[model samples]
Target: MLKKAIGGSLAAMLLAGMVLGTDALSYVTTACGNVREAVKSEITPEFELDRIRNEIDKLMPEIRQHMTVVAEQSVDVKDLQREIAKKDTKLASQRDAILALRADLSSSKDSFTYRHVSYSRGEVEADLANRFESFRNGEEALARDRQILAAQKQTLRANQKKLDSMLGRKQELAVHVSQLEARLKTIQASEAVNAIEVDDTKLSRVEGMIKDLNHALDVRESILETEGNVLGRIPVEEDSVDLHADVVSEVDQHFGLTADENVAEAAQSDSL
Candidate 1:
C-alpha cells in the first residue's frame, strides 16, 4: 500500500508540471504575436515617411532649377527693352537731322533764284549761279541722307517687333511656370499634412523648403511686374508727331526744295 500511494503522488506531480509548462508556452506565443503585429504596424509608417522624404529631396533641386530659369528670362527681357529704347532714340535723332538739312537748302535756293532773275548780266548774277549750284548739290546730299534715315527707321521697327514678340513669349512662359509651381505647392502641402503624424522633424524640414521656394517665387514675380510696367509704359508710336512730319515733308518735296531739312525741323519741333 505504501508503494502504490507513492506512485500515485509522483504521477500527480508530473501531470501538474506538464500543465504549467503548456500554459507558460501558450502565453509566450500570444505575447510574441502581439509584439510582431506592433512592430509591423510601426515599420509601415516609418517606411512611408522615408519614401515621402526622399521624394521631397528629389523635387527640391528641380524646383530651384526652374526658378533660376525664370530669373534668367526676366533679365533677358529687361535687356531687350533697354536696347529697344536706345534704337528708338537713335532713329528719332536721325530723322531730325534729315529735316534740318532740307530747310537750309530750300532757303539758299530761293535767294539764288531771286538774284539770277533780277540781275542776269553782272558779278551778282555769276555769284548767284554758283550759289544755285551749291544749293542743288546740298539738296541732292540731303535726299541721300533722308533715304538712309528711312532705312534706319525700318530697321528699328523690325527690332521692336522682334523684341515685342519675345516679350509675349516670355509672359506666356511665366504664366505656365506659375501654374506648375502652384500645383507643386498643392502637392507638397498635402504630402506635408500626411507626414505630420508619422514624422514631425521631417515635416518641419519640408515646410522649410516650401517656405524658401515661395519666397524665391515671390521675388521673381515682383521683378517681372516691375519690368513689365517699365517696358509697357514706353509708347511705340508718336502718331501726332509723325503725321506733322509727313505733312511738312510733303510740302518741301512738292515745292522742289530740300525735304530732308523740313523733316528734321518737324521732328525737332515735335520733340518739344
Candidate 2:
C-alpha cells in the first residue's frame, strides 16, 4: 500500500509538471510569436503527454488486479490464523485432559495391585540368590571346561606323536619288504628262491599297525572337535562367559541394582 501510494504521488507530480510546463511554454510562445511556434514544433508537448497518459492507462488495470489479490490474500490469511488459534486451543485442552487421565490411570493402577500377585521378602531374596547361583555355576562350568580342553589337547598331542612314530616304523617296514621282494626277483637259481622263501608276516603286522594308528588319530580328532563345540564359541576364557555375563548385566542394569532396596521394599509391603 505504501509503495502504491508513493508511485501514485510520483505519477501525479509528473502529470502536474507536464501540464504546468506546457501552459508556461504556450504563454511564452504567444508572447514571442514565431519563436514560440518554432519551439512548439520542436517539443510536441501535447503528443508527449498523450503518450504518457496512454501508458499509465495500460498499467492501471494491472495495478488494480494486484491490489485486489493482495486484499483477498490478507483476508484468507486472517481466517487461517483464526482457525490455527482455535486448533491450538483445542490441542491444549486435549493435552490437559490426557494429563488428567494419566494421573487417574496411575492412581487406579496403584490400587489395582491388590487384585493379583504379591511377593514376600524371603521369596524375592531367594529368587535373586538363585540367579546369582546360576551365574556362578555357569562361570565355574566354563572354567572347568577350559581346563579339560587343555588337558585333552595335551593328550591329543601325545597320541598324535605316538601315531606318527608307528607310521614311521610302518614305512620303514614297507621299504624293507619292497627291498626283499626285489632281491628275490634278482635271484634266478632255484636254490636262491628256496633260500628266500619267507612269509610277509612282518609287513602285514606293520600295515595293521598303520591302520590302527590312523583309526586312533581319527577318533582322537573327532573327540577334540566335539569337545570344542561343547566349550562353545572359540577362546573359552572370553567367549564362554560372554553370554552368561551379558544376561546378568542386562538384568542388573534393568532391575534396581541394590538388593537391599528390593528387600526393604518387600519388607515394607509385607508389613502393610
Best by TM-score: 1
Number of the top-ranking candidate, with lDDT as the measure? 1
Candidate 1: where is the Cα deviation over 4 Å?
Answer: 1-120, 196-272
Name the regions of candidate 2 deviating beyond 4 angstroms: 1-116, 188-272
Residue pair clashes in candidate 2: none
Number of backbone collisions per candidate: 9, 0
Task: Report the lDDT tens digits of candidate 1 across residue range 74-179.
Answer: 5655565565556556555655544554444445343323325542234444554565565556556555655655566565556556566655656675566556
lDDT of 1: 0.64
| Cα RMSDs, all models | 53.5, 63.4
lDDT of 2 by residue, 137-191 (tens): 6556555655655565565556556555655655665566556555545653565
The residue-level lDDT of candidate 2 at 122 comes to 49
Query: What would you estimate as the lDDT of candidate 2?
Result: 0.62
